[model samples]
Target: AQTVTQSQPEMSVQEAETVTLSCTYDTSENNYYLFWYKQPPSRQMILVIRQEAYKQQNATENRFSVNFQKAAKSFSLKISDSQLGDTAMYFCAFMDLSGTYKYIFGTGTRLKVLA
Candidate 1:
């Protein structure tokens, strides 16, 4: 079984600053995918970023990036130039290729961006 762990229960950042959320996982399978999803107060699960196990290079978005350590099974999200709109509950997710596309998510890390 693959399980994701988020050490931080919550996080806060001043507007325009940067914040990094920590996430680690345990898996026996070598091939799989990792994801970071954001759920705002509206309760919609949105894909923030994704990384493949085979990719040696980390993934980066406009304001989001990931530090993927395949050896340690650690994938963290870094949000730069944060805005108040970025405040949301961040979840770490994992999926395997066993024909079942199910996501095992972390408890969650609520991020509050102070204006």
Candidate 2:
């Protein structure tokens, strides 16, 4: 069974600054996928970014990026040029391609971007 862990229960960043949230996982399979989802106060799960295990290069989307360490089973999210709108609950998740697409998520990391 693969499990995702976000060690930081909460984090805060100043506007225009950058913050990185840590995440780790335990998995036996060499092939799988990792994702980061953000849920604002509205509670809608939004995909932040995704990384394929086979891809050595990390993934980035606008202000979001991921640090993926395959051997360590660690995947972290970095939010650059943070804004007030970035405040939300961030969750790390994983999926095993051989099995169901259902994602196993972390408890969550609440990010507060202050102006």
Candidate of highest lDDT: 1
Residue pairs in candidate 1 whose N, alpha carbon or C atoms collide under 3 angstroms: none
Tens-digit per-residue lDDT, 1-113, candidate 1: 78999999989999999999999999998788999999999999999999998899999999999999999999999999999999999999999877888889999999999
lDDT of 1 at 64: 100
* Per-model TM-score on C-alpha atoms: 0.98, 0.97
Query: What's the lDDT for residue 11 in model 2?
Result: 92
- Candidate 2 overall Cα lDDT vs. reference? 0.94
Model 2 Cα lDDT, one tens digit per residue, 44-69: 99999999999999999999999999
Error of 2 at 39 (Å): 0.1
